[model samples]
Target: MTVKTFKQGVFLPHYKKYSEDQPITTIDLPNEVVIPLHQHIGAPCQALVRAGDRVKTGQKIGESAAFVSAAIHASVDGTVTAVEPRPYFTGTNVESVVIEVDPEQKEPVWPEQDLSSLDKDAIKAAIKEAGIVGMGGAAFPTHVKLSASKPIDAVIINACECEPFLTCDHRLLIEATAALVEGARLIRKVVDAPRVYFGVETNKADGIAALKQAIKDDETMEVVMLDVKYPQGSEKQLIKAVMDREVPPGKLPLDVGAIVQNVSTAIAIYEACRYKKPLYERVLTLSGDAAARPGNIRVRVGTPIGHIIEQCGGFKGASGEEARLNKLVGKIIMGGPMTGWAQSRLDIPIVKGTSGILIFSPAMVAKTEHRACVRCGRCVEHCPMFLYPSHIGMYAENGRYDSAVEWGAMDCFECGICVYVCPSNRPIVKFVRETKRHVAAARAAKAK
Candidate 1:
């Protein structure tokens, strides 16, 4: 049987060998953690703890009045050090609660319940209290996803970690297969879905096998192997790959009678529903050419990037700005190379959505300047949404955001495919992002 995939996607280096087989390692508890209040897609959370206050692990320290937002919890039992604006992975400073860990640590314990007896509202309340969000970089509130108004018929577990140099999902599937399947079932129950599908890429053979063995006895669940291609893990693409459903433009997965959740996110749901564990920590990949040791590690939310690198053995080769040649040209990405944000500082705290921390040396960094598009149409050919990226990019660059909007800039997900394949080194994704921001501002102004 042929594996299913969405059209117009690209194939790139998997870059998984460095840490694919490395079992998940736990980072030593840091003295301080900077928990950002706005980790999810919706409204920012309000701090519940002030300086000098004490907090416990898994305690809710931040919450919002908004229904779309997820709560924030403490990862360590510590005293509140401060609550201030701090740098986050998205290149912006967010209001964060800083905690100084106590000298003596106490093992964090949560409520353990019989999941079979819980109703849908109870499960959703547990998940919302746990601060569960999409761990695959979207950071959308999982409780909101579970409470969709539309009737769902199928749920797709996006196990296709197609991004290069990232294997946290693969490692999780191998290590926590039972939990993931249980989490998927929990989601099915919440949405009242009849069928569940694990859409895994062909490259993740071990993950697929492990999940199959775990769910083989379940009649409603099926494991579907997807094409080993880029963007195959995207929600729309995964829905198409597994269920042959195409979500119409300007719509959502709920519109097509389907819902998708990340593999790690599913594990989180299981942990939350069964053990009443809040999402205070998550598994992430730390790798790249500059990394001294490449591996997957479970880390506390709000831990500094610099601390994580030190525990992983720091950078490869030399140290300091003088010895590091890439200091001028290289970048440290907060996620996969294709869609990750380039970071200028190492002090930012990790969030629930952070999947990988990839480092690039000067040699590995792409060297290119802004140049005119050759109009080879490579961007259009590789675009999963089939939009004219060149036109949007040019219009955005020329400050003609209206034209860019007309060219369907808002439809672009900034997958970085056009930028990756551009011969002229055009920062197409960046331009599209700027245009979208402008369009959004215009819409907001008009609405007022």
Candidate 2:
């Protein structure tokens, strides 16, 4: 199983040194939790429980009629305080279920089952029932991803941990190697893929070594090292790097005889299959100058960000003054700097899709005023998808979404490299997403 190289991916500074070596620890439960109903990509789930209702951990609180959507479960046993529009990381107030925690922690009782004798269909059913989704920022339902109309030829496990200052996946690979490997094998069975490969970045030597050791006897599973680069862990980029196959525009990995799953997703699959437990907790990296204890923490879903920061020993300096003293504490981000959202408030809870909580002091975080695109072509040169971002950005800026789509705007992966390297500091990716939404709406109207 020789590793293959892909084209045109930049090696950005991996500030992973902050917590790469730190093992993941669990955060203490907070006084209350804010569980957003629309955490996944599909239609927002309707709330099932009302205020004053007592809900147990893993109880379904929100659900959707759409097959593409996933159910939302209560992360802890508590009394629902409110079910109304609340501030989320998306910069919008969406409907969320607020719960007041009971001082005595309690576990939700799940139905007993024997997964060892179950077939692939049973396994898929269990995963769907567990409300499992990709924890790697995408938040797409894991069951939907594993379900493909066409046959999958190969399965690629993403362990690259490419995002800087985020070592949750790296720690999972090292500490939960057995579960990760077993999960990959289960995915191979579910998708009926003959071959499975785990792709880890070269920077994570320990993770690669651990995974290699875990999968040594399984010839179908191989641990391959990837070049350390921003967005290298992305589905399209990883597929290109590991299999040399390009996922065409408006097409999926299934079109290329491949299926990709994150390491965290694999572990979740294993849990769903083995213990019949729903996804309620995930590894989250809490790092920055503001964090007195910067490291990876296994956080229970729906736990408030404020509690997480408190558990890590609250911010160093007093209120407004803290930002100045902590070089990396200017603003708080919910995921990796490249793909994460800049959060407005720390009151928002950690959702299933949260991979990291990055706090940047004004100095560590770069802030530049927007300037006109010089057409220097650095964005095009660095785009992993080979789409011309400058043209798309220009079209989007001018409100010509149709022209942007014609120029392959939908193909833009939104990796934020264009935003990162732009000398003019233009919000190229943001404009591209807006244009994409416009195109989607127009197409939907036309279809009707």
Encode model 1's per-residue lDDT on 1-448: one tens digit a residue.
Answer: 5698999889999889989999999978888999999999899999999999999999999999999999999999999999999998877789999999887879887668899998899999989999999999999999998889999999999999989999999999999999999999999999999999999999888998898899888899999999989899988888888889998778999999999999999999999999999999999999998888999999999998878987887788655354345473277899899999998777888999999998878889977677899999999999988899999999999999999989989888888999888899889999988997888798899999
Model 2 residue 213 lDDT score: 86
> How well does candidate 2 match the true structure in TM-score terms?
0.95
What residue runs in model 1 are displaced by over 4 Å at the alpha carbon? 320-329, 446-448
Which regions in candidate 2 have their CA more than 4 angstroms from the true location?
1-3, 108-113, 319-328, 443-448
Model 1: ten consecutive residues of lowest lDDT: 320-329
Q: TM-score winner among the candidates?
A: 1
Minimum summed lDDT over a 10-residue window in model 2 is located at 319-328
> Model 2, 339-395: lDDT tens per residue?
888876778888888999887767677787888889999999988888888999998
What is the Å distance of residue 340 in model 1 from its true position? 0.5
